[model samples]
Target: MSKHFWQTVGLGTIAGFRSMTAPALLTGNLAKFHPQALAGSPLRYLQKPLVATGFKLLAGGELVGDKLPQTPNRIAPPVLLGRLLSGALVGATLYKINHGKTLNGALLGSAVAGLATFGSFWLRKKTTDESGLPSALVGGLEDILVLSSGLALSKGTDIGAPAGRAL
Candidate 1:
């Protein structure tokens, strides 16, 4: 489970940079090796229209302005990918926590999410000279906010309790 979470984080981070490549790589890898993991719980929710769209875009190679239509820049793809990856990691972490009767699983989950989001955001900042320092700092801070918020909402106030159970 830990290995899978880390792999997903790495893939999601890569996807964050080139929204099209990461999902295609992830879907293919999951379909090939981690097929069972994709079948249940929060991971199953990925069988949705938005994920399909992302898969299509990724498969179609829209990342490098190759073999795709010219569309204005937007943040939708990366954001959606981030959410999906985060949810999957959180779900898997919760499952392990419940199955093992553990209390620290959610914290681990949040750390993984933070690592992935910050890794991606940092990579983007370091690689792109177009965006100024202010944009990068603000964006990195936003990623941290999102990760913290998601962790709170999914893990709730107590780790031993069920996720969002108190809500």
Candidate 2:
């Protein structure tokens, strides 16, 4: 698979853990490094610094919320849908920027996001139970994983790959 494919998959995986994170990181990347990548495209807004900032703020909230006792389950229908959309958005953005089909990217991203949601949830639960770690601590660890991975995947678009040209 191409690096972009893996990057999209990684972003989808990040969405599974934290819904806003992948989009946030993607938007931030576009805003800072590839302003013309989405020119004349509906996804152009993603390149706006304001949009990137907004997503970043939302990502921050998600990070904190994930550790809260009152936060809802990530697999809940509504929340799950949000994660799916988040994955789709970033995937589409990356694919479009890379001259790939947006729908294909969306489908790949959504599918992985769904699978990762359940898989990660189970793993988080198991880790907490087996190690006697607080759920919050485990969630904090997940935040680290998602952020590091998301950032890398987002920046990976620049591996000498041409950004999507007004697609």
Candidate 3:
């Protein structure tokens, strides 16, 4: 797979943690730095400032909602589906900007999201159950990680690589 494939995986992983966050960061970055990447494509709407702001609001709400007691499991069918779609959008948009096949990006993004959904859920559950830490606190920490990583990945920063290297 190409570097874009790995990028989709990174974005999808963030979607698994917070369904709207990947798109939030992705759209914001696109709107600010790659407006022309989606020219002539339906996805270009995502580059609009309003659309990016909307996504950011939704992502913030999701982060807060995740800490609520009534929040459903991330693996729930409806919730999981949303996360998958979020990842798909992130992947497709990245691919479009990078001159890759959108469908391929969507597939990789959604697949990683599905896996990360369960993986993050299990990891969070185990840590909470074992360490006696509050789920809300753990989730807050996750929110930090998601935001930091999402920003970097969306900005084409390669993980584990030299500072100047990017995808």
Against the true structure, what is every candidate's RMSD? 11.8, 2.4, 4.1
Model 3 lDDT tens row, 1-167: 66766878898999888999888877777666644557799988987889989999999899899999999999999999999998888888777777778898788889999999999999999989998999999898888888888877766643212122232
* Best of the two (1, 3) by lDDT: 3
- Give per-residue lDDT, candidate 1, residue 103: 26
TM-score attained by model 3: 0.88
Runs in model 1 deviating more than 4 A are 33-56, 59-62, 65-167
Q: Which stretch of 10 consecutive residues in model 2 shows the poorest summed lDDT?
A: 158-167
Order of the predicted models by lDDT, top scorer first: 2, 3, 1
List residue ranges in candidate 3 displaced over 4 A. Answer: 35-37, 155-167
Off by over 4 Å in 2: 35-37, 155-167
lDDT of 1 by residue, 1-167 (tens): 54434433444443333344444443333333332333454555433555646675653544344212353222446554454454344434344423432224333433444455456556545645565655445444544543444344323223222232221
Error of 2 at 86 (Å): 0.5
For candidate 1, what is the lDDT? 0.42
Q: What is the C-alpha local distance difference test score of each model?
A: 0.42, 0.82, 0.81
> How many clashes would you count in candidate 3?
0
Query: Considering summed lDDT, which 10 consecutive residues are worst modelled in model 1?
Result: 158-167
TM-score, each model?
A: 0.37, 0.90, 0.88
